[model samples]
Target: MSLELESASVEQTQEIAQQIARLVEPGDVILLNGDLGAGKTHFTQGLAAGLETPTVPTSPTFNIMFVYEGGRLPLYHFDLYRLEDADELEDIDYYGTIEGDGVSVVEWADKFEDAQPDECLAITIRILPDQTRVLSLEPYGGHFEDIVAAIA
Candidate 1:
C-alpha cells in the first residue's frame, strides 16, 4: 500500500517521519530516496529522536553508515550516495547489519536496487516548484503494511 503526504517545512517533514519512527520495531527497514538537500537527513534526525537516541544524526554520505545505540532500539543509518556499485554492500556488511538488530534507514537507496531490503518501507521525497516536499510511502511487505496504516 501507499500513502502520500505534504510537508511545508523541515519540521513538518521530520514530524511525519517521527510518526513512523514511533511505530518502528527492530528489523524495520526504511529506504529513503530523494535528491540532494531534500531533507532525508532531517527525516532521519527525527527518527533518531523518536527512537530516543541521544545525539543528533548526520548524513553518513562519507562514512556510509553510522549506528546509534541506547535508543529504544539501535538506529542503523546508511548513505549509499557515494557508492559506485552494489557489490560494495558487502564491504559494509549491509545484509548482516540490516538483518541483525535495530532499525535500518538507508538514504540514496534508489541508487542501488540490490541494497534494498526484501521487506521495507520505501519513502520517496519530491521537491515541488514551491519548495514543498511531497513524501510518498510505499510498503513492500506485510509487516510494513500495518506500519503504513498506522502512520496514515
Candidate 2:
C-alpha cells in the first residue's frame, strides 16, 4: 500500500515522521528521497522523538551515519548524498548497519536503490511552489504495508 500526505510546515512533516516512527521496528529500513532542503533531516528528528532517543537526529551527510541509542530502538541514520556510487556504501558497512537491531533511515536513498533491501518503506518528499511539502510513502513489503495502514 501507499500513502500521500501534505505538510504545510516543518512541524507537520515531523509529525508525519513521528507517526511512521511509531510503526518502525528492528531490521526495518526507511528510504528517503528528496531534494536539498526538503526536510529529510527534519523528518528524522521527529523519528528520534518517536523513538524517544536522547540525542536528536542531524544530517549525516558528512559523517555518513549516526547511531542513536537509548530509544525504543536504535536509529541508524545515513546520508548517501555525498557518495558518487553505491560501492561506497560498503565502506560504511551499510548492510551491517541496516541488518542490526535498529531502524535505518537513509537519505538520498534513490541514489542507491540497487543497494537497498527488497522490503522497505520508501518515502519521497516533494517541495511545492507554495512551500508545502508532499510526502509519498511507498511500501515494498507486507510489514511496510501494515505501517502505512496504521499511519492512514
- Among all candidates shown, the one with the greatest TM-score: 2
Give the alpha carbon lDDT tens digit for every residue of 1-152 in model 1.
79999999989988988899889888999999999999999999989988889989999998999999998999999999998988899999999999988999999999888667889999999999999999999999998899889888
Query: What are the Cα lDDT values of the candidates?
Result: 0.92, 0.93
- Looking at model 1, the pairs that clash are none
lDDT string for model 2 (26-113, tens) is 9999999999999999999999999999998889999999999999999999999999987898899999999999999999998877
C-alpha lDDT of candidate 1 relative to the true structure: 0.92
Q: What stretches of model 2 exceed 4 Å from their correct place?
A: none
Scored by lDDT, the top model is: 2
Each prediction's TM-score versus the true structure: 0.97, 0.98
TM-score of 1: 0.97
